[model samples]
Every structure is written in C-alpha cells, then in structure tokens.
Target: MTKKIGEPEKDMSFLDHVEELRWHLVRSSAAIFIFGIIAFLMKDFIFNKIIFAPKDPDFITYRAFCKVSRFFGTDGLCIDKIPFTLQSLEMGEQFSVHIWISITVGFIIAFPFIIWEFWKFISPGLYEKERKGAVAFIIVSSFLFFVGVLFGYYVITPLSVNFLGNYSVSELVERNIKINSYISLLRSSVLASGLIFELPIVMYFLTKMGLITPDFLKQYRKHALVIVLILSAVITPPDIVSQVIVSIPILILYEVSIFISKVVLKNELKKELKNG
Candidate 1:
C-alpha cells in the first residue's frame, strides 16, 4: 500500500506532535517579528500616510463619497471636516502606541506565513485531498483577510472617525482625541473585520464536524441578519450609511458560508457513499 502525502506513515507520540506544533508556532512568531521590525522602521509612512488617511478629506473613500454625493445632488454625504485633533497627553504614550502599532502591522503583514505554518502542522492529520488544498486555503484566506482590512480601513474607520470625532455632548466640550484611543479604534476595526471575513472557513469546519448544515443557515437567516445589524452598529458609527455599508459585506459572507456548508456536506456524503 502506498502512503498518502502528509501521512507520517507511522504513529507519532503525543510528545512528538507537541514538538511539531511548538516549532510551527516558533516559525510563525519569527515571521511576525521580522515583519514588525520592517513596520517599525517605516513609522513615518505607516502612521502619517496609512493610519491617518481617513482623517484627511482627500482620502480615497472620502473622495468617492464626495463624487457620489454630487452625482445624487445630496450634500449630506460630503464630509468636509472631522472635528477632532489627535493628541498625546501621556509622556510615554506615543512610544507605546508606536511599538504596539508596529507589532499589529507586522502580524497583519505576516498573516499568510503564519497561516501556512499552522496548515503545515495540521496537514499531517488531514486526508491527501485536504492536504492538496493547502495552497488554495492560504490564498483564499489571505485574500479575504486583506479585503476585510481594506473595507474596515476605507469604510468603517472613516465613518467612525467622522461620527465620533465630530460628536459633542455640549458646545462647551471640545473633542481632544487621545493618541491611544485613536490607535485602539483603528486596530480594532481592521483586525475585527479581518477575522469576520473568515466566516466561510469557519463554516467549512463546522460542517465537517456535523455541527451545522446549510438548512440551518437558511432557517436562521433572519436571526443572522439581526445579529449582523447589531454587529454593524457596534463596529460602526450611529449613522445608517455606515451601518448599511458594514452590514452588506457581512451578510454576503454569511450567505457564502451557507453555500460552503452545503458543499462540505455534499462532499462528505459522496465520500461515505463511495466507502459504503
């Protein structure tokens, strides 16, 4: 009998598996650190250009919004000023924020490699067909993550900044946005969106485990819509446009997840039929 690819061809002890996982984690961490160093060196471009892009009126999203507003003859969508200034009050706040931001950026930059390492570790337990899908898994997951990051940066971040940056309980109180606060918002928006975009991947695993089916997704789609709306509200500002913008992609992802579950179930059934 021929041994399958990724199969050890011999039973490995628990300690051996643990050692393998540790090495995979070590490699993933090294990749993150290398990317982080690069990000740290490019602080000027990262912070001034990328992180702070949404604050400027000429940001790509803002420009698109302006053009759309003009075409519709509606002045409501045009954002002229984000009525807040970012300030660092604590003496070490800027340094701390810089380090954290670089680390986060590094993780984002190295995400694909990290995923590859994880796949390598897990692939040994998967079937030959599943092992063959490694490249597709990494590519699709990476593409989805980057897309989510861009959506958060260009859409959710701007809307939140515009709303919170301008919102004032009273005319007496001026918005003095702290450096840490701003960075936190930016980090959360990007990271949260990136993870949320992995819905289909999550569904595939759940279906494989026989935990959820496509019928379940369809039956509870209304409930999912309500949850998505609540999630949009939590992530975005209190504006309808921002909420709608965030909700749309998430809803689409949910539908795609359902389709993924259906496919997974179909494949499993076919496998069982062939074996029987």
Candidate 2:
C-alpha cells in the first residue's frame, strides 16, 4: 500500500487511476445534485432566514458586539443599523441568485459525501492503518467547514459589512450595495475560511509527497508567522484585535500540522528501521 493520496499503486495503470477518479467525481456530483434538490425545496428557510441573516441588525454578531460595548462602560460596536440596502439590478437577478445559491447550499451540505468520494479514490493506495484513519476525513472536514462558516458569518461578514457600509468620502455619497456584491462578500468569506481551515489536511498530503517536512516548518517558523499575520490582515479589518484573532487560530493549525507531520515522519522512519 502507498502512504497517501495520489500515489500510484503497483498494479494500477495510469488509465485505471483516471477511470477511478472519474467515478469519484461522478459520485460526488450526484451527491451535490441530490442535496441541491433538497435545498431547492427548502426555499423559505434558506432565503428568508439563512441567506439574509447578516443583513438584519438583530443578527447574533451584532448583539454580541453590542453586549461587549456595554460591558466596557463606554461604546464601540454600538451601531443602530447597517445603513445599506441590497437591491436586485436585473430582471433575472433574483432568479439567478436563487439557482446559484441553492447550488452553493447543496455543495456545502454535500461536503461530507464529496470528501468521502475523494477518500475512496485515494485510500485504495494507502497502508491499512492510514486507510483506517482516512475514515475520519469526512467528519473532520465537515467540522472544519462548519466552524469556518460560523467564523465568517459572525466575525468576517459583520466586520466587512460594518467597515465597508460605513466608509464614506462625504455625506453626499450613499451606500446602496448591489445584491450580488453583498452576496459575493459573504460567499468569499465563507468559502475562503472553509478552505483555509483545511490547513492540517493540506499539510498531511504535502508531508506524504515529501514536499513538506517538520524540520523545514520549524526552521522557517518566523517567516511563516509573518506570512500568517499578513494573511490575517488581508482577510480581516485593519484593527489589531481582529487580525490577532484570525492569525492565532491559523498559527495553532500550523503548529498542529507540524506535529502531525512529525508523527507521520517518525512512524515512517521506525518502519524503515524495522525493514532494515
């Protein structure tokens, strides 16, 4: 058995691997379609509540920020309203949004099956022990996605909305955000975070490829920190607190990735020693 995903098996030809991959993709697409149907049927809950959630002043993030401001005895996040109106600018805009949003929702909901498909495609080449651990792939990936979504919704989306909505050159300018633009912000934040949260998984695959090493991660530790901080700054507002909050989690994940990489390398070394 091979050590990780994408490693070719001894008996498996290139065409065989391609055929296997094709099936995996097909199954994953089917899962997404199934979930999309469900999302299409649940229009009221998806549209009226979840999708439009951040636009409402009574959103959870706003309430939490207001509480924090009150607890400090002064004021910070005490916004009366978001001060922006979302409008559809095209005749088919609303309908287009509905279709795409349903597809996106379907994709998110069917993520576990997608991961399973990926695992099935690759796990055939892994060692038995590694293959066993791959069973947790779907669960961990789904958990990370949910956490990232929450982070984007409560932290990223609200901060972005507040900053961009309130930002003005003069009193003459009014902020009337296009519905697509607003949704783009929300979608980007969520998808970006969701992908970022898979840092550990990325590290695992890289380690297997020998593209990443624990010693290398440790040697360039300061450099990685700088990059992480810069990324945090890019994703978040200019405030130190927000950047720190985002950077801290990523640093933790990097450290965890280092540890996981080390563990894997250690086991491989031990197996090599035994073979020798």
Tens digit of lDDT per residue, candidate 1, span 60-100?
Answer: 88888888998998877788888888999999999999999
CA error at residue 238 for candidate 2, angstroms? 4.2
Clashing pairs in 2: none
Query: Which residue pairs clash in candidate 1?
Result: none
Q: What is the lDDT of residue 58 in candidate 1?
A: 78
Q: Estimate each model's TM-score.
A: 0.95, 0.91
Best by lDDT: 1
Scored against the true structure, residue 202 in model 2 reaches a CA lDDT of: 88
Off by more than 4 A, model 1: 1-4
Candidate 2 Cα deviation (angstroms), residue 214: 1.4
> With candidate 1 superimposed using the best TM-score fit, by how many Å does residue 179's alpha carbon deviate from the native?
0.7
The predictions' CA RMSDs to the true structure, in order, are 1.5, 2.6
Tens-place lDDT digits, model 2, residues 1-276: 235554554678889879989999998889888898899889899878887887787888888988998999856877778788889989988877778787888888888889988888878667767777865877887888878777877788888777777777888978888888887788787777777888888888888878989999999989999999998888777778778878887899899999989987888788788768
